[model samples]
Target: MVKVQQSKFVASAKKLTQCPPEDIAEIAFLGRSNVGKSTFINLLSNHFKLAKSSSTPGKTQLINFFESIWIFKEEQYKMRFVDLPGFGYAKVAKTLKEEWKKDLWEFLNCRSTIKLFIHLVDSRHTQLEIDLQVSQMLEKLCRGDQSVLKIYTKCDKLNSNQRALLSKQGLLLSTNQNLIKSQHGGVETIRLEILKKVFGYEG
Candidate 1:
């Protein structure tokens, strides 16, 4: 099984200008606060504390990076997981919120090393405006050069049948319906296909 050989905190970015310069290929995880972005990163990397997770919304106030070195077939390659701060918290000041948006936009638009953007969404709530905005931002950034994958988080909360149904319905309603249909079926199936198409692997 693929495993994260090393995962350590790299840096934090309150402003995109403050982000570190790196040439490594990067994949980012973004979602509204309390949507499980941190948990998802931890689960994928097989490191519980790799990304700080919390039930409290808006816990992450800055961009957190985890330097992940994956080991497979006795070869090693470095990967970066960017945990972007969750937006849409009602208690945040308007000025701070705007700064956060600007920071996110700069990182997504200016970071040349970013190879993939993983848009995470809560499986139970499919119609969040903030999530849609994030998706659109990634789409624009892709500019036909790269790709973005939408991941419906918290799938373990659903039974197999419920998961399948949700995936089917999500595919049917998405703009990329054909792409979803070409997969085994539904959102989870489509998610796997998207990952392969975008990142050149199922991971």
Candidate 2:
């Protein structure tokens, strides 16, 4: 059984070279600004302070790495969660925003440790042009063996019927857009899905 017991902040990298040596599998989170990526990190750690959650969009301007301890049927493994800078609508200078975009593309194309990409979409709205661009870029950059998961965040605000309707949308077929709320059982469900992806667990 795979179990994530604890997670801790590791380091922030401005570029791929600055990232810690690629020694283990990494799951990177990518999304638009204010899409609750940081909150998802905290949820995975089960520690409110694990990843900084800011009210202001674009506060995460670098690749933040969080190391977690994974126990799979008593065997320990080290895994990483990378919080990539959000792509759109950051309150930064145009030049800086472009630089962030460049760095993100470089990281995605060059990083060897990345096993999966967790792409987050705000469930309250339909997909945006940036989201499609991201999907296209990942399709080109990620290796054939790599994986991607599409997650719709802040699903608690939607009614059951809305969620059901959104879940069946053609665009959400890959990861099935399982609507996820940050609070309560939703976080745990998200975490478990992540583990399922990592460990190839059916349970």
Candidate 3:
């Protein structure tokens, strides 16, 4: 069975300067507030509190980090998860919101350890303008080594035809359901894809 052998909060930072200087592989989780990013991370790690979830959106202002080790059969891999602050709809003062965006942009474009960007979008609201902006920003800022994965959250709410359409669109979609049988084990599939990106496909 695939399991999170070790998962712990590492640190929280407001900017790249304040972040840990480790050069290890990192996966960045970013999305609009209330998009289930924290819950998705929890499901992936099998540690519910590894990333904090808030009833009110935009509660996570700082960039939170988590170090985790995963064991699947005989293979083990270590990596960091960077939970970026939610943007766009945050109910912050306009002045402070600008500053937050500045810090977030700097972190996203300058963080060298980030091997992949997991951009979570709510499946029900797939046409949101904010998500498109974030997707554009990721594509524009991504380097040769970094790739972006857009996983749609709450996919179990979608019907089979909608899910099939999303699949046909060539988008990497996933659900936050903890069940291994849900949506063909979507969460586990995402975990394995993340592991492959971090450690290569040798295992």
Q: Indicate which candidate wins on TM-score.
A: 3
TM-score of candidate 2 on Cα atoms, chains taken together: 0.84
Model 3 root mean square deviation, Cα atoms: 2.2
Off by over 4 Å in 1: 54-56, 168-203
Give one digit per residue, the lDDT tens place, for model 1 in 89-123. 63777897777777778878888877777777877
Which candidate number maximizes lDDT?
Answer: 3
Q: TM-score of each candidate?
A: 0.79, 0.84, 0.90
Candidate 2 per-residue lDDT over residues 117-161, each given as its tens digit: 988888786568989888888888778657887777776676767
Ten-residue segment with the worst summed lDDT in candidate 2? Answer: 170-179
lDDT of each: 0.68, 0.75, 0.80
By lDDT, the better pick of 1 and 2 is 2
lDDT of 3 at 138: 86
C-alpha lDDT of candidate 2 relative to the true structure? 0.75
Query: What is candidate 3's local distance difference test score?
Result: 0.80
